[model samples]
Target: MEGSLCDLPAGLRGDYAAAGPDFTLPQDWAAYTPADHATWRTLYARQAALLPPHAATAYREGLARLDFTAGVPDFAEATARLRAATGWSLVAVPGLLPDDAFFAHLAARRFPVTRWIRRPEELDYIVEPDIFHDAFGHVPLLTQPDFARFLEAYGQLGDAAARIGALKPLARLYWHMVEFGLIREGGAIRAYGAGILSSSAETLHATTGAAARRLRFDLRRVLRSDYFIDHLQPTYFVIDDFSKLFGAMRDLPAQLAAARDAAPIPPGAAAPGDQPIP
Candidate 1:
């Protein structure tokens, strides 16, 4: 369950056709087997139960607005609820996508989710993001107005950064904030990042695991931090408010430039300037 698209799960195969320049594909809803839907139900039930204590309230609210339960969601139905809520729609993709293509979709208010679900054995770990991870993990939060805009701006900024070879810093930003970040609510820290959202096991580990480091969220610090793609993140950056994240995008281009000169620090390490969470 490590590495990039090249590091696919061993001995598993699916003949997904090549994707378009935009990385959009057909969800092929009818193609899902009983086992596929079963996998969805299993993962959804377990993860949903764990969410209340550790996840952000927005996530739970979004689920009520557009539920993916009862089975793997039909793209049209799911996207309709989302579009009605926040002008965001879910689109299908083959799998992992090129950064530019991904950004382009986000820039247009479309979230490209991998079309296929993971194998049953891969319920816990899969090298590439499967439908469960992309949909259940990510789509709910996109239903919120402010969070939706933050993602759209991130995409626009990412498109610009990709051209100037400055995408790496922004990629780190997405990694820490979108995938593994935390936020404070009522004096309690909770998980909002998708990587923590979809995985029941990781959610429990992140919120209470003795070895995890919970740190204060700082923009430049996140941009300069390195992370492990294949392991539970060793550290999590907690934001006090969602507006703090949205406001940063106002100067993301400038921030990316300033951060360009700073070398990235690996997970579990912090820059001297960081306001570490206690």
Candidate 2:
């Protein structure tokens, strides 16, 4: 069926949970079918080849520590490596959790991951995050200290953003940086976000001879900018260093309010095209 897990017969939430842990998988580590292994291999091989010249050094090194081999990763194994590196860990959750729950998890230094993998036919894109996207795309970056701190700060700020009806803009910030951001390393740009690392198409577009403009990380401008949920990103924020991002949020609540106070720009407005700064 096209929807597969998502299309489970009605009243199936209980069934799904009973089938296994509702929030996190056991990493069955050895239960993967040949097909599953092939899927992982296919995705991994493609990204590995494409990311070296394009991906940030931290992301590249994190990928190695993940030690993706021939099958679905053991969350236990992955979490062990990640915890040692940055004290961050992954928690499994049913797909598309409520924003509050999502933020709560992140606030506590835990990432909510969808427990299922995408079917072979649906490899290029999936509506919700899959195991590949969560485990492969996102987890690796959690290994970096600065990125890890920024994520925690993001979560804490999410609470305040929610209270002020600013969660969307805050999420836009996350989408731009943690999920699809590029970074300047030694005077060269490279990919660091999970959304870019896990997808072959975005991986190429982000690094190759493409038409996208990579801008320097500007928190106020980023929160004011709009992003598309259903397509490739029209723009990307480039970070000089992940540490800068972490430090930028020291007063995230105030900054978010400031951005909100500024006249809202239409979604996707270019930085230069924004209303003149007062």
Q: Using Cα atoms with residue i matched to residue i, what is each candidate's TM-score against the true structure?
A: 0.92, 0.87
- What is the per-residue lDDT of model 2 for residues 179-270, given as tens digits with 9 covering 90 to 100? 89888888777888889888888877776535766777777888877777777777787878889999888767877877776765554456
Task: Provide the overall lDDT of each model, using Cα atoms, as 2-decimal numbers.
Answer: 0.82, 0.75
- How many Å off is the CA of 194 in candidate 1? 0.9
Candidate 1 structure, TM-score to reference = 0.92
Kindly give the stretch of ten consecutive residues in candidate 1 with the minimal lDDT sum: 1-10
Off by over 4 Å in 1: 1-18
Which residue window of length 10 is worst by lDDT in model 2?
Answer: 1-10
Q: For candidate 1, lDDT tens digit of each residue in 1-278?
A: 11234433544333344555455767889988999999999999889998889999888888877878889899899888998988999888877766767787898999988888888898888877888888888888888788899999998887578666787899899988998878889987789888998887779878778888888887878888899999989988998877788888887888787677777797888568767555
N/CA/C clash count, model 2 = 1
